[model samples]
Target: MSSSAAGRPDDPVAALAELTEAQRQQAMRRWRLLRPHLEDGVAITRLAAATDASPRTLHRWLTAYRNDGLAGLARRPRADKGRRHFPADLRLLIEGLALREPRASIATVARQAAAVARDQGWPIPSYATVYDIVRRIDPAMATLALDGEKRYRDVFDLVHRRQAERPNQIWQADHTQLDLWVITPAGRPARPWLTVIQDDHSRAIAGYAVNLGAPTALTTALTLRQAIWRKSDPGWHVCGIPEIFHVDHGSDFTSLHLEQVMADLRIRPVFSLPGRPRGRGKVERIFGTVNQMCLSQLPGYAPRGTRDRAGRAQLTLAELDTAIGTFIRTIYNHSPHGETGVPPQQRWESASFIPRMPDSLEQLDLLLLTIAKPRKIHPDGIHFQGLRYLDPILAAYVGDSVVIRYDPRDMAEIRIFHTGHFLCRAICPDLANHTISLKDITAARNARRRDLRAQLRDRASVVDRLIEAHQVPDPMPLPPPAAPAEAPPVRRLKRYREE
Candidate 1:
């Protein structure tokens, strides 16, 4: 028969075009198996013996190839390709068992199905057939049935990902404990927390803070301030007030102080749902990327479960901070984003849109720089957290209830406000020349208090012993004379018992 009439092809490419993808793959596989016999004249029996196929199958394939071309070697679609012969009820039962909570093993499901089939006098399916039925169930349905709604939502639920059209239209903030350990100022190894502010549109990191303490409202505020203000580094240019500040449902993010700052800046705060963190996935991805690309290369890279990770610590917090800043400016911001196909810094600058900024750094600081605490001005100064803050202006406001705002990073100085008006910046004379953090001051105060309490306990025990000594009368001195008289009488007259 001619090639066209026999549905065969003299050209391999033309033959492939006429067949579906599966058919084409099958034809290629068969061609590979028959090549030695057809081209090298190897015996058919030898080829069959070497391969998984038998001689009869080899002969059929060879004959078909000779009659037609490569097309004849392609497997034809079966009439019952997807249709199963089992009863509808049996299929449902198998699926139900497979999808039960605490999902049974495939073998267990097959055994149970076989037992049920035997009891019902229905056609029992082989294990492979049972497995195929279980596999055919929709994965989403199976996940919901076997796992739970939460797992199903996390894995299979369709998400409406949030995206910003402009660079400053949306910003996301989040905190993660870095994988690397760094030495604190006090020479202790600690895993630092990293708070990051990022532009949603460009995926550019605007500002970040590395601190030994857990993320607090002050940390978030400081990071936000850094993000909104222009950077001193010429290479890093991402800054400005965002239209929408997106964050998770963390207490720091939900603080009234943060809310007030957002209101003053005309930025709307968008919080993710209480238990749903998917909304913050964009910012969260940056943490993993940083851990893998930046931190994993650094000294003391303590990924979870590493023993003696602290012993490997070599870099101080400041050094680590500088390293992270360098990485962001030199590498991360410059690298092309996998999703955007453009470097973050380049994308952010491409729009040429001027960001909305505070009128002045002072104005921004007034809102985002410090945590506010209500303090009454004493005769000496303002007392807060066991530290005395002094200012000449405070002399006039003595005994007055005023508000003092201080940077947790520097407890040496604080800004005093009276009835919401800016007052003088007060300083602690005791903490002058050297910077002392709020945490340091607190730790010192606690240590001192503990020491005083220990002394008091010792003194209290001594006083109790003295009081008992003074209150008790001296032991009566009468017993010695009576004992001597009885011994003398017994020696003189042993027989006079009455005397």
Candidate 2:
């Protein structure tokens, strides 16, 4: 066949065009030998003369074709095609040298390979052969051999893409340290961490928590609590127990408390493989949106450096949280999503079935709160973290060890659970109706001590002043008191005589 004919785009012969020169020569030879038989009977002598081949060689080619077909006509590989001229173990040693720490040069590797070959009394490979072997090592394998699995995975691992079947069927939760700074309770600029839960199908943000502390299981649970329970804001209607909860293999995700909560709710917890995040792409995108859209407009947006914004961080932790909540409800949920082509809120609410929920907010709190501990109810009440907790219901369980669950932010009241059943809320008489944190308690104690010291100082000053005034005081005249008593006695004696 002609070369142009072999290079036709739609023909099987097109593959021959991709072959090297030697392979093309062999394929052409086979085609020439087979072409004559497919056509009218042609003289072998004429074919031999046209091809400049001897008749004996043509006969041999025909015989080989009849025996092995096209494969027989193709050129045979040499006997020593893959046999290494140098020591067989030398290639492995070269790869090892290439992967060693403080990597050596190719020349150094060649020299080392030669040394090993000399010691073993085997043939040494040429520089080109050694270089080829070293260059052909798989990059990921080489990275693993040199560095560690984490580096290799981060550089070369494949990410997973998941599509949930329906809204509320699958949800992803993760935490990210936002590129924004907010004022902490201590009045200092600090970057805050955000824990968010998003529905995979609709891309709706179900719940999130903005806090000054690092991400922990407590934060994760709180985010999930808001996600699963009914929202006070009717606009954000994505609350439900997800069929599958996707999260990274973080320590917080693996906490026993979180695991128990998932089990109680019958929500399957699906953890992405450690060091591999094929499943967390959706939530990661949401985090990016928050940084680009919402936080970038905030006053203390810290994109790259600590104080990137010109103005100081003005919003406190609570205020920043409120801002984020407002954004998620008003802007993000209502805005059209690129992938879903509709608002996340509408997509999640399109379905009609009721979501699986805890019996009440108290039941949900008991399952999700991580601060549950068995404390015996004293006659006064339950004492937790140095605060006294009291409730009328606790009078029934006095001296009995009952479990109390509470939010770390609020020490005013705790939810009581007796033998896995929720009892009632216990209030601290001092902290009643007050949201007092441990730091708040400590601050109040310090202020009280300071006030007591000030009062004692004032009393000391009064005592000193009185002592000073009495040290050299003029005695008041006693005659004025005696004159007043004598007038009254004279009037009383006249009245008594009349009677």
Candidate 3:
């Protein structure tokens, strides 16, 4: 290499950029602090304020650099170097205090050490010296002593960023507890949970579930269901069975139901090592965006510490669900992502390759909702939790026990399985027309009570108005004649969810 090109002092920054991050950080810290002196003839007072170091210390570093090139800018070692020597007790005290369970500040330890030194008639170490000693201690030692092994690994662990070459090759699923609190079904303020499945290639949120409860295998399965099935909205076309399901080491991801479903579909499940979630960075990044972009604007956004009135809870879980749906579709999916530099929706749809999919939506529903229950088929119908389901196919299975699967949110129908084979979908006579949840029924009852009380209030006003108009009420007037009644006509209702 030529003399001019051999990492000359004039281009130290250019040379520094070529080094690794750790080495660059150490070198840059010294270079930045000393740059003002080398380039501009700046004042000591200005340099002190800029670097937060004493003038004497700045001069010392400048002298060191001029004498020994870039290497001299580093801190000078003691005669014992890494080992403890003169004022050994003080050095030990500072490092011990730094690595204590509940860490002590340099100033605090310096003051305490001064007190002990006075009693022992020994020299008291300055705060700066103590600070330098603590700062130089091995980072691994500090992490292990203060935050433990888990944190040490979290901070210093080696990670490989992995992604699929194309969409549907691999998918990532994970859950995050949102920062905003929403009103639960029980009418209490609670944080809602979110489960999202993303394409490893495009970083698109293929499917998501927002609920005010702990994440379960059901939620993940349902999310996977949405991801695999074609969407009604044409804009959202990211559908297909994924070749690989990548997820963290969560119980919800490792459930037997998920295993069975994946096995049946031939989709492999890849779990990140337990307590080391480095591979989940892509999903984690999405969650961070949600916290910053979506939750921050929400009504009940709870940030760290001093929970003031600004974070007052307002939206219910249902309302939040609608909000989340709108945000995901309109904003998040359409916006250009930081990593991919393209809108996730556009990226997902840009490809022409067909994704592998299930034969039918029914087959998907049967596999995903694994809440199967064994029930006996009676002559009248199949009996379930307080509801009787009827279907012509059940007539043949009368007096026989069959397994049934249902969605708790809707008890309008249940899928029946005879001897591990799908028989037919049986409908509940009363709730056949509309999907009904137990919570909805409870809410309806409350609403009905409210309406009756409102009617009573209206009647009271009517009585008061009549009394004011006629003090001597001319004995209540005769009721009007009844209208003619015709024979009630019989009409068949529309079949629910007709195929």
lDDT of model 2 at residue 446?
Answer: 64
Quantify all predictions' global Cα lDDT against the true fold: 0.86, 0.79, 0.79
Per-prediction TM-score to the true structure, in the order listed? 0.72, 0.60, 0.67
Worst 10 residues of 2 by lDDT: 1-10
Instruction: Candidate 2: give the clashing pairs.
Output: 160-278
Alpha-carbon runs more than 4 Å astray in model 3: 1-93, 111-124, 304-312, 430-499
Considering TM-score, which of the candidate structures 2 and 3 is the better prediction for this target? 3
- lDDT at residue 355 of model 2 (Cα atoms): 79
Which residue pairs in candidate 1 have backbone atoms (N, alpha carbon, C) closer than 3 angstroms, thus clashing? none
Top candidate on TM-score is: 1
lDDT string for model 3 (107-213, tens) is 88788878877788777777777778888988988998999999988888676778788889889988988888887766778888988898988888899889877
What TM value does model 2 have? 0.60
User: Any runs in candidate 2 off by more than 4 Å, and if so which?
Assistant: 1-99, 103-142, 145-147, 158-160, 304-311, 336-342, 351-353, 392-397, 418-422, 433-499
* lDDT, candidate 2, 389-442, per-residue tens: 865555556678888888787778888889888798878878786443556545
lDDT of 3 at 366: 58
